[model samples]
Target: MEINQFLDATYLKTASQANLTEEETQQKVIELVKEAILYDYKLVMIRAIHIPLVKKILNEAKSNVLIGTVIGFHEGTYTTEEKLKEAKAAIVLGADELDFVVNYTAFKKGDLDLVRNEIIKGIKLCLDNNKVVKWILEVAALTNEEIIVISRLIKQIVFEDFGEENAKNVFVKSSTGFFKTKNNLPNGATLEVMKIISENAKPLKIKAAGGVRDYETALKMITLGVDRIGTSSSEEIIKREKNRNKGY
Candidate 1:
């Protein structure tokens, strides 16, 4: 398979997170968009604020690389209403997909209603606007059992309420690439975590985000049932693929 088709070229770091000035961060985003246009990757995953900029550039270049953004971001602590508001604004700004961080903390606390309600509302907003939606589970923060349950929860809600036909646009994404785990453990998609999510969230697509730095790991994640890969290293991965094809 063509790796670029399965890649979501991502750059979601904030200025503080990368220790760069706001202008520098914006320049990086501009460069990312140019790369996406040049490579023709499936989508450019970025911050909502960058959506308008990306849209402008992609349009100017007449490129079809999609625009994806996050809601409730690295932390799923925001209220459902707040997330919805953010999502609505993103759609208005021309985002093609919305990756929402599921409130897994509430799910772990056994507040099923809070978690379920947010998924329902957030997904409905995306579907209504004809935009793709992904639910980020932040796998490192949850136990294996929690991962299975949450993935199943998203699947059940989508299939039962939103109808199966819409499943193509709904993805159960793994990670925000920002969670700080103890001992510097992998804070992204792992094979074990992805297996649990894949077996349970089927029908709904899977996006493996975070820690996917090289071509080999990205291929393995796709082989293990990841429908899309969210990574900041798209250029390197593509370069490695080219080198391997030439027997480098």
Candidate 2:
């Protein structure tokens, strides 16, 4: 397998959480971008604010690693207009892909229309700009039934509103890595969650994020038909692959 192509090296730490000043945070983003380029990862997923800096770094390095950013980030409660504006700005700054945190809270409240509207607007904006879009469902926050419902809803809406071909460019991503669970359980991609998502979201791709930190788990996700694996441990995973290749 072309493991590098399957990995989206990610670093989404903000200024405060990372305990860095704005300049320090920018430096960290640059380091992440450089690592992605050096390793030839499929993409570098960062916070939206660092898109331009990443774009500049990749351009200077003569790298083709795609640049991706998150919208509405860990929280999916942003107004649709706000999400749209963030998407537009990220694209203007050279983001090749946008991963949006879907309003699952509204969906859980039986407000499917609101959730649907936000997704439609976000997807349309990305498609119109010839960019890739992924909707993050934050599966840790949902029940099994909710996962099936929302996964099916996203696929159905994408296919019905845009043609099947356009729908192919969209992804049903699994997590945002920041969901606070009552049980304090893992809030990212798991085998069971990947199975549910893959089984429900067909034709449209799947991006497994959160908790996919090692080589073996990442390979398992790909085996389950995941199209992308988001991880901050891309280098470590790749190193493990190398060790295995050497008969270790």
Candidate 3:
């Protein structure tokens, strides 16, 4: 597949407090949106909290990408019910899809069924409310085996709820940015998780977030079948990629 095709889809992922004001955050998001359009990039995983100010950003796109948001983001402690509510609210505000954090600790504690059920519930809620879902496994917090299990179960659970064809919209993603962890596992975890997801979650979309910085890395993940990227490093990556293409 072409690297540009993967660039067609990505997330601005403004998970920060420094740019919190509605005006300031909207300015940042709009600038990213326009940057994507200018570079021929197409879908964006925008933030839910900033949805109210998304209109101008969405309108500014000449080759506008689709808008997405995160659920149980930054933390996976929220109940599946909370994720469902947030997803509904996001859908009402025009979210094309949602990136949900899976309760990995709960799964590690042997509540595997509960984790799967919760994800299925969230996806059901989104579909019932007319939206799509991207389930984040947060690989930084999971073992490689657990990652495989979660990726496998996500595909199974989504199909069980929404049927095979509709399951196409259900994605598995890495939200490894919760906190800086020891041993540097979370740092390059997206690549490893993408390998497992690409191998196990056949035909399912995979999103890579946290720790992505340059074009080569982005291109590598996309080649491994990552459908979208979540990054705060868009400016640096785009410019560097452009310069590389120009042989600079």
What lDDT is reached at residue 158 by model 1? 94
Could you give candidate 1's per-residue lDDT for residues 24-46 as a string of tens digits? 99999999999998888999999
Residue-level lDDT tens digits of model 2 in 10-97: 9898999888899998888888888899889999999888887788888888998999999998889999999999999999988999
On TM-score, the candidate that comes out on top is 1
Cα displacement (angstroms), candidate 1, residue 161, comes to 0.3
- lDDT ranking from best candidate downward: 1, 2, 3
TM-score-superior candidate, 2 or 3: 2
Give the number of the best model, judged by lDDT. Answer: 1
Clashes counted in candidate 3 amount to 2
Q: Would you list the C-alpha lDDT of every candidate in the order shown? A: 0.93, 0.92, 0.72
Which stretches of model 3 miss by more than 4 angstroms? Answer: 1-5, 8-16, 19-23, 60-63
Question: What is the per-residue lDDT of model 3 for residues 154-186, given as tens digits with 9 covering 90 to 100?
Answer: 887766667888757777887746555797655
How far is each candidate from the true structure, as Cα RMSD in Å? Answer: 0.8, 0.9, 2.7
Location of the lowest summed lDDT over 10 successive residues in candidate 1: 1-10
**Better candidate number, 1 or 2, judged by TM-score:** 1
